[model samples]
Target: MVGLLLVVTLLTYIIPAGQYARDTAGNILTDDQFSYLDEQTPVSILDMLMLLMDGLIS
Candidate 1:
């Protein structure tokens, strides 16, 4: 489990994050508007660790 968590955390840094637009009904529209953000906010290692702990605890 720890190994999997570590892998996922590393992937978060390597993968380019993306976003999708939502319509009035709150449904995600993956049309032309969907795109990979050029500037991705970096997630701190501590934050990722805390998130994993929180998920396990909850």
Candidate 2:
């Protein structure tokens, strides 16, 4: 399981970042406005753990 987590952590660096276009209403627009970001944001193990905890709590 630790190895799997390590692999997933590494894959986050390989994946390109992206975002959905938001309108004036501050809501995500599902139009053809989806685009990849110029920079890559890699996920840290602590962040992954925090997300996991949030999921479990919710």
Q: All models: lDDT?
A: 0.80, 0.84
TM-score of candidate 2 versus the correct structure, residues matched by position: 0.54
Steric overlap count per candidate: 0, 0
TM-scores for all candidates: the values are 0.63, 0.54
How would you encode candidate 2's per-residue C-alpha lDDT over 1-58 as one tens digit per residue? Answer: 7688778988998878898888889876767788998878898988988877898899
User: What is candidate 1's lDDT per residue for 1-58, written digit by digit as tens?
Assistant: 7788777777888898998877878876857677789898767778888987899899
Q: Which numbered prediction scores highest in TM-score against the true structure?
A: 1
Error of 2 at 2 (Å): 5.2
Point out where model 1 deviates above 4 Å.
none
Model 1's lDDT to the true fold?
0.80
| Error in Å for residue 35 of model 2 | 4.0
